[model samples]
Target: MYRQILVHPEDRNLQRILWRTSGDEPVKEFQLNTVTYGLSCAPYLAIQTLHQLASDEEDQFPKGAAVIRRDTYVDDILTGADTLEEARDIREQLTHLCAAAQWIEQR
Candidate 1:
């Protein structure tokens, strides 16, 4: 889920990693292009991204947007509806909402 949110280009430098294959090798720098799991800001960034997405697509997915804003926890969503029909509708809305951001939800 974190990997689905891209880091801003200017901020990618802050997520850089240095690695070496062997003791004799020079260190190589790699810039992370997405929100990584272990970074101190990862949780905030991911949740904020979801909020932004909900805001952006609210008109098209009000139910899903509400779920994102109210029920999302880190990478998980815990929500329920009063009726089976409403639950299905919410699921559809959430599926479409996530698809809008290219974030696939695995059942």
Candidate 2:
């Protein structure tokens, strides 16, 4: 089973840049200026980010790869796989993704 990971967006600090021309509009892109997603108080922000990433990656593999995410008071991730290898692979990827975030097993 995949680890119930708790990722924090603060691990990567956010930065805002103001670059606007006299006749140009302003656009912004969130810049992750910190580590990974495990070094802040609000861990759910990072969890949300990971959830989107997982969703995007769900179709990459044909196996039974279901990335489950629960964000109540915190972030909870449960990855479903038909085989142990697939499960373990998902867990490994999650660990790597949150290499800087705080994560532990559900049970």
Candidate 3:
């Protein structure tokens, strides 16, 4: 889930990785293009991104936006509806909302 959110170009520098395969190898620098797990700000950034997406697309996905803002926790979403039809509608809206954010849902 964190991997789905991209780190801004300007902030990517802060998420850099320095690695070496062996002791004789020189360390190489790699900048992360996506949000990484275990980072101090990862949870906040991921959740905030969801909220921002919800706010930005509220008109087109009101139920999804509400779920994002109120039912989402970290990388998980715990929500439900009174009826199967409503549940399906929410699922569809959320699917489209995620698509808009380029977040591919993993089954």
RMSD of each: 4.1, 12.9, 3.9
Cα deviation at 65, candidate 1, in Å, is: 0.5
* Model 3: residues with Cα > 4 Å off, grouped in runs: 103-107
Q: 1-107, model 3: which lDDT tens digit per residue?
A: 99888776898888788999999999999989998889888899989999988998899999999999999998799999999999999999999998888642321
TM-score of each: 0.89, 0.33, 0.89
Against the hidden true structure, what lDDT does model 2 obtain? Answer: 0.46
lDDT of each: 0.89, 0.46, 0.89
- TM-score, candidate number 2: 0.33
In model 2, which regions exceed 4 Å deviation? 1-32, 35-41, 62-65, 68-107
lDDT of 1 by residue, 39-91 (tens): 78889988898899899889999999999999999779999999999999999
* Model 1 clash number: 0
**Model 1: lDDT of residue 43:** 94
**Regions more than 4 Å wrong, model 1:** 103-107
Q: Choose the strongest candidate by lDDT.
A: 1
Candidate 2, residues 8-100: lDDT per residue as tens digits? 456424443445555467655465443333446336554464555456445653221244343222455544668998778777665554442
**lDDT of model number 1:** 0.89
